[model samples]
Target: MNLDELAKKQSGSIPGYELVDYYEAAFPVYRVIVIVAILTEQNLPVVQEYILKMLDCGLNNIGDIGGFLGLSNEIIEDSLVPLTQQELVLSYLEGNSLKFSITEKGKDVMESLKVKKPTITSLPIVFDALTGSLEPHKTGLAKAKEVKDLEIPIIKPYLNKPMLEDIEFNDVRKLIKRMQKENTDIAPPPGELLDIIEVEKAWLEYKRLKVFVFYSAKEDDVMVQVFERTQRAPEYETRLLRMEREGIRVLRTVKKQSVRNGLLVENLSFNNEDLKSNEESIQEAEERVKILTKNLAEAEEEKTDQTSIHTIKRQLEEARRQLEIFQKGDRVLSTYEHRPILEQALKNAQNRVLIISPWIERGGMDDDLLALIRAALTRKVEIHIGYGISDERSSNDTYPVKKLKEYLSKSFGKYLKLHKLGNTHEKVLVCDEKFAVVTSFNWLSFKGDPNRGFRRETGLYTQNPVTIKNIIEDTLKRFNEASC
Candidate 1:
């Protein structure tokens, strides 16, 4: 997409900006120079060729301006219309039929354009327009090829369509990791870290899905090895191997509770507050779900009340109906995806973000940093927390922690629950409903000095761990943070 069009997309709508729009806009403008340069250098046939050639060198390969290869007098004449003049390459002769040279101001134009290339572009386009290595289809192709030789011959051709139509599946950890890598600037203070984190969040929904999903049948936009529809039985040995795999899958257990099981106690929740909107739904099916929880049915009654959540003496006496699952197994954590644990936790940390620690204090996220939270809230992202730190003994009891919590509520329009613990303990931060931010940052470090502080800071990401994505995320969440 073009610059103006992408900018309009970003400024015009807050909620409706598509993922492509976001990526395109976040992309830098200088990156476009690469595309322009390639075309111009190659003497390719395209209008961009002229634009790139002029920008790269004063001379142009095509569309003569004067005696030298530069923008022709004809192109400048076209600019008289309602064309945007924010950043342009103008080629005009000082004398009649004379030589062409770029003015200092025009050179400045090139520099400025190079610097702010994608300010007006989409975030998604940055990868393509600049980096040149975004192959979303590769993963999809890999998925299709995962299963070998087995094929169904009896099924109809019409039934072999792929399952996912959109790109960016539920792999939140992978993309979040990408963002973290993009923001590798050294930390000026904790505020810088918080700001980058918030930016990732502000645009989280935009990248909620980057991993594309394609049907097995068509080998078009996405790559796929084979797709067929049939239910033919495999050999006895094959069936035995499949059974063994299922047996191993059972060994990887996680506690997935049912709504009936009140064992789960959510540290943070909407609890029916007057808070404004957020990108995703705020209410969770249950604060703590039962282990081995499956597609349990939701109550026909709307989940409008808070006390009604855990207040129930028993599980839904009888769920309207059960969702389908091959086995009613406990939540399973994966050993292979140990790295993605933290990322998954952070990615899933929406709706209500909770940070728990024994020593809590104020000024966690600075002014510029806090503003990003408001921006996120304007986009409907909620940041909530509960920290365990008593203000009774500090120089001024409740001074630091109180100040920290207050700033969170005031600046970000988020409610941060402050819990003073009369006992010593560990640190933790739970995000949204599905993820938790368990860390070692003390309550005082909320805004304490990062260099020399009493804070024994550490933490990791955890998944209720069932899906491979979740398994990987929970591990990485902690690993990445520890590395930092």
Candidate 2:
């Protein structure tokens, strides 16, 4: 039988033969041969020459099937190793030379091969527009071949067609619509061309999967270097082997995801071009929308409250009455009443712990308070201390500040910020901008001082963001001014 008749009969009835799965299994080797054979009927004797010729068939020719598959030569060869082991292709010594040719099985498989057309119809000539490789076209061909026999009205004419470089965008859209309408197994799903960000994200995902750090040294995009190594296990062959497997898996996943998303090279290129052309307009529109949104929000905020003055006065008086009553749950703490509450707030600090204690005696920076600061700092909580330490004072006020600085500098110095204030008596501590304390009781010296000698100290604690924000902001400003 002729090649066409043989393909038609055996392609249907060949036992255990699935064009899609087989083609996928045999890939680039299947692709490389088909592309080369179709481009030039003359069977090239040399494998390298054959590969190079196949490369020349397309715009990109970065040596071997790597250019076509958008992968490295090592990875492509690794994939071919399985096919070699399967005995699908024949390789034997021919007159002191290692020669390779397609076996009968390979021929049958090649005959069954079909290339899908992924031509993009662009009005403006877009040469060298697509990046990476022409893998989609090759895979599209295989998928198209597998479904060539389907009687779908929309895709019938495009069956068995060679992959095209470009076609009308609208024509592609129409074909996709028809494919959706027919609901045939053979019709490839609509594809989206990945953009710059998406392509980078895919590469990042690939590197992440491979556990390798990918650093592109090419600043202006003239040259490129791809790193496939982990710092943890540098200069090891085993790591490279793992990386190869990971690279293959990641590539396969990326390809599958891209195809599933209906991402087409031609369409993607067209989309990028469209984006580039309209980027300025898009940015301008976004800015306009932002302005309009801000205006709308301000307008809403500016709308006058309809409540009368008499009603507002009554609400204010009721709020004052509630404050006077001191609700049971009000967390306002005092050194006399809830000294432990202060320590608990310090321990619970998650994000930021700001302490504005003007006078810090050596006794005030107690073991418990210092331990809490250390623990909070270990949890990445930022600690800012605004202290009043007079140089003139003997080993009392200045001594504690000096000791605290030394202790913090040893371990948590980087996280702990010391802002020395001149003489301000503000004693407040804000934790994570949520819980706060404004107290007359000195944070460092309060607990240690004897009740008989100590002044009648009192403090107010609040868990209000507004109250905390105002206190922190005002105290921080004062602290900054004093530090200056």
Candidate 3:
């Protein structure tokens, strides 16, 4: 299901709370490497199997066995000691030479030589950073710094560095056993975790997940539900709760950041395009009704077949009904149409462009978008930007904004005006007084998050001259009201 439907379904489950907002947020995870020893089943070496076969075949002397196997006497002697210790081979002194023979135990072992036998070995084990659970050593994990898209509003890890350091051998051993029981293919079977040789290394990482945030003003409480692969992730829910108990308050922090940055907003509203489309539909229906009415009058005057007159009346009635529905139904902008509309406005604007977004970050101001802005500036189009939703400016990377400002200041500064507002959630773009867009999308801070899937962002696109003029004027008024 779509995110909106999913949110609605989740909201119904809550007693008195409503789904206030949903956003893509980061879940803290750690990648830990620990050196450990495990007792596991392994296959017997080929050389040992070959020696048993030779001894069973009555090739007893070490020199003769080595010659048959194309190995030296020293290698054969080394292979014999383990076999003899295991009671799989019998050694005796005869005629001034040591001789060997395969015992019943050795024959039995030979029958299943290809099967895995019990052995203890040392290897590196990687643990799931969040749950302190065991993960396969070769599992691919991303480093926290390497995550590029999670720029703001992070959910802090409940499991901290000190806690990672204090992870004991017994803890890892239990985790391994638990994993083994859960998934044999991932953590294999018939194995016992031995001693932890050392805690090798640990580093922070993030697991990206969709979060639905619900709040009840009456109770002054917030509920956060994390989703992975479209299902509720209880482990993450527990982690978030523990984080709250520890006074981290990640949900509150995320909500505050999202609100300040205009990432959270109410549902989309009717746009001017909706009214225009409805008007067009009503006009088309009126034309149809007129044509059908003329046909009905002609059919009756001409004394045509009763069936023809009846058909004309039916068509006219249907047209009138459709006209009524078009006049009364609510209208909305299609969710898919906003991005291209904004891009086209950016590309085609001639005289001026005004943008108001709560935050300015690199995600929205990509190289292609920068090129568009530069081209517009080169053409001497005035570009006015008003931003900053929180009283405290965002700590996100300002390199994109700074770079654009420097370029404009050096060459086309006259065409640029940058304003930091006290606080606003208005996401608008007006271009060349030709078109304007008011949206829930953060035009300067949000591009799109692929990991989070699609967000339900919608906007009104209007080419109405009066509406555009009013939007541009109001946007500039806010810009002028705020500090430059």
Candidate 4:
């Protein structure tokens, strides 16, 4: 069906809607109601409003279509554009504005997504493989007036299939209650069955249109996006050696898995290394969980009932711990978000700018991020970029200080005093003491479409003094202190 006819027939999610999109096709395989709950019902109207008013894409310029639909101008460069890189959409420059329209595949996705106007009963919880994660669901059911203990149901995307009857929703509800109350503790399920039950329970509530299924592996994606163009060689042993300390492989891998597969290019050959590092991270996160659990246990022993403070603190601790793991490093990390909502995060930082990228160049970066950097420079943000040049082992075509020096001079201008430090391999950007964006992105990955610059790369952004000091001081230590 044509776009206009589909619109007419669908009538734009009219009242009393219970519609769903059962994607029998590829990309965004979601049940209709679930789609509405996850990506659309809540934010679609906002997007519609923006398109109707702000954007003016016509017969002339239609640069990146998915971006136009998926993001506002502010986050288009960081989030939406990265999606385009992953072939999720298409985006390019047009005059002063970024005029975008969806690709045929994206359009097919739009058609495939089941949309409906769900009741204001529940919100979505998407378990991203990459960016962010989920906290166990707490409906305030026990906190609320219990109504016959409506067995906490587990929902699934396979909407019509008969659910297996063995798992009891009652036990699951009790488990959620313990998790929520910390009678037990926060954890991944012990086995595949528990995991399935977890999914099932999540799905049941989800079916009531409670959540979404935008499966995101942003962690791995974030790693892949940032590390692709990183210069890895046999010599200048620091960059290569640090991987062992961090339990990551030094070399990058670049290959496509199969014949039908469109070139799967993985440059960071440190797969085993990364896996070990990631496992260590997970274990550390769990350790923190144990600490919090201990605290909760002590609190429970002291009191007859758990208070709101404990609950909030428990949630906050877990979320914060996860954020730390998330902060480890990734390709497309942002200082803050500015999409579907407007934020002036970068506004007040016109005084002193500090940027440190390990490799410093690659992505389809001739776009918005560069625009911001230039704007900062024009406003005399006093840019001080510190890059760590890895000791060259191979003498290959790797761009060392000379290449980086040339790129900085060529792209950022002669006045751009980009400082080159030795011995560090972290990606960070601290903007004018006002904002700090700590990431895993080197200079090349930041601008590389091959890095998924626009999609959903995860990083930590903060104005909080605690977060700021931790990132900046640690990075500075890596810079000033000498280590081989």
Candidate 5:
């Protein structure tokens, strides 16, 4: 039962090792694999190696643990300190060399998790008053592969039950495939994956409406809500809006139903406005489906005799490559609509962040932006800021810019560089020379204000290394020329 005995037993499992950790009880097997690989597989002494592994497992960074883990990164990160203190994990610096290694005690902690058993408990059953039905609410399951980065429900602390039935596996696989095809970034809820098969008919009635339901699992409550189509009140607006469009009236939930396994069901009713949209969407879908079905049938008949398996395989491979490229390079951002695109790019910047904005001032710098910069700095990301001085602008209007520069110099010291240019007006952001955003939007001044009739800004975001390299070279050249 102790850590030592558990580690010994787990070590016997060898390449097929199992991980057990009380603290990491809620984590899925894949995540545990990440930890196990770091502790046992990665021989590199540098903490950077372990960090890279986390990134490979879909974590943006050590700070972005919550983005993947569905838990606080700070908690996991802080736990490492105590791990070292207890001699469960060793940390040392040899002449500016940083290294991390799991001690024998650490292996014991992992071993214990492998042997741990889950506690069985009864799930809360929903009580439907209107139907007077006492049917047990069935939980939905997603294939583990589909929700690889999603936080899956743990049957009990440190215990996870595997999917058993072949029918269920095939069903979940199809659902996951559909989800991946439709939305790559969206994951299913903890307990149940939404069965779109049953909803497709109803969904087609409003297929034209851009609607999405994102769900999350709290301690004892499963929160499910639809994405906002209309821009809410001023106070409700986020720092970034993914879609810049006017709102339309939607189907509203009328009566709340009881919860089962933390899943809350509700009765929804559509108003006249919603019904009108639904009718339009249904007609469009019918016409579109008819055309698509006809085209598909013709294509299939033509290909049936002519198409070779090898040729089909090659076509699929090519299609996958194109999809990957499109997904990476297709992110076009408008500062007039979405500024968070740039903000997120900055937050995810690991090695460097290069900004070329003609004007930079403290007035436009919000707390969120400041925090992002500071976080990047903490990760040792180089910050290069290029700005211009305008002849039309007053010399006395330099306080905000001056304060910003002073703060950067004082805070980040050697990692920060501020370049003053002569009337430069280009705005671009390049991160690690791997991702770049070139925009007409002022990175320093513009925050999407609906009331402000500012110039509608447009920007292109690309992950193409060649494109990023060209932009970086050109921007650096301009910065150098402006200095002269």
Candidate 6:
């Protein structure tokens, strides 16, 4: 499974958090050369074994031994130096002829070499970057060049510069025992760990892993979960947290700085246009209200028929209501304000409500929100919804949408329209011509869970007639486009 699937699995455990986003990140993997002593067998060379056996059989002369072993006398003399120095062989002059003999030590050595023998030998071992555990040397680790080419962020270890002195004998011993128990082919035979003679710190490598960042607004905390090979790596998460606490900026910092400035400018330009249109609409609606009020006053002064006066009063009230709808200045809503505004709109809508959000999941469309929808549908309020950010609808949770269709289609299908758009980033909610909200908040995918950590989401809540009309028209256009 991919990071998305892994994030979903992780979501259930995070009580009040939602999976906002995930990204590719890396952990430092270092290649360390550790000189370790292990218990292993050392075998005698074939030629040496033959010479020793020959000497034991009373072949004292080099010529006789070499002849039997199918080697020249010169070769026999060269091989004899080590044996002699090791005290396994003795050289003597017998009747002016050089001869060789196997010592008692040589007999013991020969016998011991035949069976598995424990020997102290230095070997290079690798240290795990995440757990700081010892492991066999591995190849195919991602190099700095490969990691640089990737667009992901890299989480540098708190101890950036690792030294060989950090490796200890006990760590190596435990690793060897574990490997032996597991019957790993690469592990040395079971034996005691000798002193760690030397450690050579090699170049740092990187292992790409997935990271899911969760925000808890209530606690004002950020929780990070890391994954390697589709499994949670809590040790790595701890490392990241430690780095951050040590004044080292990590994933969150990188993500913040990576936002493109050009996109911000484009969004600002669009918002400015909406603001200008709202101002013009407000001015015109104010003028219309003034004219209606003046007409109602003139009719009262003329003492018109009771029916005509009553009609004028009703018209004047409608004009004032329309003016009020446009005069309530637009507002900037925070993450906390989105829910109540959306719910209020749903509850108070008289004619229609239009919502456009990219995703629909249980997190946003909980039982409460679903009930509100049901009430709106029961009132015969026209509800149009547009969702989906990918070409395939399967990318989203289909079960919720399916259930909605199955439950409401029979009775309210005519009034409820669910349009799966090919792709959209727009988060909008419009209630008839009364008010509308346009923001970064995902209205259908996030329900402003109080237990969730803070996410910096803001929306423009507007009662301006022109802005509301534009949003509603644009939303319905998208719905029509998607249906095509």
The number of the candidate with the highest lDDT is: 6
Ten residues in a row with the worst lDDT in model 1? 32-41
lDDT of 3 by residue, 291-318 (tens): 8888888899999999888888888889
Q: Which parts of model 4 are misplaced by more than 4 Å?
A: 1-348, 392-415, 443-457, 474-484
lDDT of 6 by residue, 239-325 (tens): 777776776766532121111121211322235566567657766776777787888788889987889888878877887787666
The C-alpha TM-scores of every prediction are: 0.22, 0.30, 0.57, 0.27, 0.33, 0.45
lDDT of 2 by residue, 1-484 (tens): 2212222222223233221100001111112111110111222223333333333353222234666656686764554443345444545675765444544554443444421223222111111111112122212232333322221111111112123433333443444445546764533434432111111111100111111112112331111111222123232224333434454221111100111121111111123343343444433444455555555455556763445444444554555454433322224332233335556666887778787665665334545567777787777778888765456532233445555667665666677887877654556777776666666655654322121221334455555566666777776676677753
Best by TM-score: 3
lDDT sort, best first: 6, 3, 5, 2, 4, 1
lDDT of every predicted structure (CA atoms): 0.29, 0.40, 0.67, 0.36, 0.42, 0.68
Better of 1 and 4 by lDDT: 4
Colliding pairs, model 6: 215-453, 216-453, 217-452, 217-453, 217-454
Give the worst 10-residue stretch by lDDT in candidate 5. Answer: 200-209
Q: 282-378, model 4: which lDDT tens digit per residue?
A: 5567566667667666766677365754684767587666956554432222211211001132234656655665444322122344555566656
lDDT per residue as tens, model 1, 1-484 = 3222332223322233211111100111111111100001112223333344454575532345333444465653343111123233434555554333444544554444431121111122112211222222111121112211111011111111111221122222243345445563321111111111111111100111111011121221211111111111123213223433554210111121122111122322222222221111111222223311332323224553555544342343222122111012222221112113333333444555444444433223223333443454544555433333344434223444434445556645444333333433444444454544333333223323223312212233333433323423443343333311
lDDT of candidate model 1 versus the reference: 0.29
Q: Residue 303 deviation, candidate 1, in Å?
A: 61
What is the per-residue lDDT of model 5 for residues 265-309, given as tens digits with 9 covering 90 to 100? 011121446435544554455445555556556667677554554
Q: After superposition, how far is residue 56 of candidate 6 from its true place, in Å?
A: 3.1
Runs with alpha carbons beyond 4 Å of true place in candidate 3: 1-17, 36-47, 57-76, 85-87, 90-105, 111-126, 137-150, 160-197, 218-220, 228-232, 252-353, 362-383, 388-397, 406-417, 420-468, 477-484
